[model samples]
Target: MNASSDGSTTLFVLLGRIADRTLDDATRREAVLVEATLRDSIRAKALDVPDIAQAARAARERGVTVHLLDDGGLGPYETAVADEIRGAIVGHLRCATSGSITVRILPAGRPTLAAVVVQSGDHTERYEFPAPTGEQAHTLFHGLRRGVGRSHS
Candidate 1:
């Protein structure tokens, strides 16, 4: 992101450095918040300004979603926590033939988020959970497969 560009399609690299005056602390990391600005409009990027008040005002005016997750800065957390998430999913995937699984970190929080899309022939099942460590994934995939453990007389 160029720090000196004002043209269209210019990228802006901003830090979450809006200070907290109420706490009266002068720490750098503590002052930063877990937030980012999304500029859908041409003039929606005033958060990069030198003044904190103006930056906050622009954020308040332009912000629509309750949660804004920019997890680019969370690489360490993602790497360290992905294996546990994988462990939670491996057992349930025994029956899945064609499917897709997505594992994601919670960004500024603990407990990873995972979504799995299982395909058993034409039927598909999708689920979102905090890294399923149980039969949740198994049930979704197993049920989609017909006549698995049936008693035939």
Candidate 2:
């Protein structure tokens, strides 16, 4: 996906085939919580705010449901961006199956995030990406997608 005109916004485009079915009830509920938390965090940001509201609206328009998790206390802005990226990734995974994607932003040594995708029949895949800053978070977002694509191919 191309970066936004100002270059601060990273457009997450899902190139994979979207599934025909909707997310399960529990998963759908979780997605709502994540979106709400993300929206709150974005509003609390002091600077470098991304257009999360716009992206979320577009995702809803496309019927994309997203779910996410974050460890408390990691920089709000970074965590918000990571959460946003994770939500998009989860939405992409939903297109393939009733699978679930859980994104965790760890409060470890450095800003690190992990995405665990669990497919139907119990198959699972995990990806780790660095999210030290907004730009790095964007790179991590794309890297995860590219890595997943390569694995499936």
Candidate 3:
């Protein structure tokens, strides 16, 4: 569905959920095709092309915090997008959760970026990203290191 142009900033959140019996294989494939067609149509009619870095910078300037989880092995464009996202995030979390799913970020020693562990019920998966620079690490881990302040008695 298209977003309403009501002066508010639009955030397009896309979550690719695992296919299930309810959706079936064919239905899932058709859904993907339909989304691609819509995206192509929008791109064709758009006056200005979207830039990831510029968008991320705009969001940051508006005091909006961003968080990113890169699953690695991205194409050139996707890698650029990930870099922009990384630049926008104010802080990173060691762990984040959504319902039954939990994402845990772990240090991958030298060279490699941190590894991410995704746990859902009995299933678990892991992925790694390129190592962050010292400054980037500080920016990313600030929230992870900062615990909730003590309550006043």
RMSD of each: 17.6, 12.0, 16.5
lDDT of each: 0.31, 0.42, 0.32
lDDT of 3 by residue, 18-126 (tens): 3323556755554554453344234322211233223323433343332223333222323443343333221222232321211122333444443334344565544
Arranged by TM-score with the best first, the candidates are: 2, 1, 3
- State residue 58's C-alpha deviation in candidate 1, in Å: 51
Where does model 1 exceed 4 Å of error?
Answer: 1-82, 98-112, 131-153
Q: What is the TM-score of each candidate against the true structure?
A: 0.26, 0.37, 0.22
Clashes of 3: 0
Model 2 lDDT at residue 114? 43
In lDDT terms, which candidate is top? 2
In terms of TM-score, how similar is model 3 to the real structure? 0.22
Q: Model 1, residue 15: what's the lDDT?
A: 28
Q: Is candidate 1 or candidate 2 better by lDDT?
A: 2
Q: Candidate 3: how large is its RMSD?
A: 16.5
Least well predicted 10-residue stretch by lDDT in candidate 3:
144-153
